[model samples]
Target: MSHTSTAQKKLLSRVRRIKGQASALETSLEGEPKCISVLQQIAAIKGAVNGLMREVLEDHLRAHLGAPDISQTQRDEEIENVILILKSYLK
Candidate 1:
């Protein structure tokens, strides 16, 4: 099985925290629902997830695009992938 590295492990921990925040939002949904508080928590979770995505993207770029010439084809591919991710999820 593939294993996560140290940086990935840290990112997973942060994502788990976000999952807890999302669970809290769901539980709150069943209650009278503190609207503003629940919304704030949701926003926080979204931001955390975004940060995790950014970290993964940066790691991919570093691992795949390393070279004296950052203008290489591999670097271009990395940038294109990042753009695709942003377009698909961040928008």
Candidate 2:
């Protein structure tokens, strides 16, 4: 999609950072890192992934379901359905 094309650089950056975090986590496992330190790295990775998800989701909403030409009622329903899917996905 055009929106994704526009966001390609930003999305790839986030993915690269997430990959670095995963590498750090693996390195930590190979050493004697404290449990809390390892957990913190894991948490950071999770947060980064969630941030990426949020950005992609927002772009999808804006470019597709939130298009200005759609009827209001249909747009509202589509948005609600997207929200429902997101909620389930996060659980």
Candidate 3:
């Protein structure tokens, strides 16, 4: 398959699974499961999102973010952008 197709498959698979987890979380609320179960579901969603981000960031870095043999200035720019991304999510 083409790269875009492969990437879409991966993303779609992850999102579908995440949707199921969210549904389970909602059902769990009806039964009044422990707080931990809710936390786990939330964590699973976060992890799914993080995995997607990792895949996208890797692709971006390989395709456009930086050269394999980037100059110092280019490397600095890429590093700064990555740091900014992390900071944005951490906030």
Which residue pairs show backbone clashes in model 2? none
What is candidate 1's lDDT per residue for 1-91, written digit by digit as tens?
A: 1223757679779888988998888888888877898889889988898888877777766666655666677688877877897899856
| Pairs of residues clashing in candidate 1 | none
Query: For model 2, where is the 10-residue window of minimal lDDT?
Result: 81-90
TM-score of each: 0.77, 0.80, 0.66
**Model 2 segments more than 4 A misplaced:** 70-88
Across residues 1-91, which tens digit of lDDT does each residue of candidate 3 receive?
2444658877788889878888898898989799988999899988988887788778767754555776888878878988999899878
For candidate 3, list the clashing residue pairs, or say none.
none
- Candidate 2 lDDT over 1-91, as tens digits, reads 7999998999999999999999999999999999999999999999999999899889988888868898989888888988897889789
| Best-to-worst ranking by TM-score | 2, 1, 3
| Better-scoring candidate (TM-score), 1 or 3 | 1
Top TM-score hit = 2
User: Where does model 3 exceed 4 Å of error?
Assistant: 1-6, 67-84
Ranking by lDDT: 2, 3, 1
Root-mean-square deviation per candidate: 3.2, 2.2, 3.7
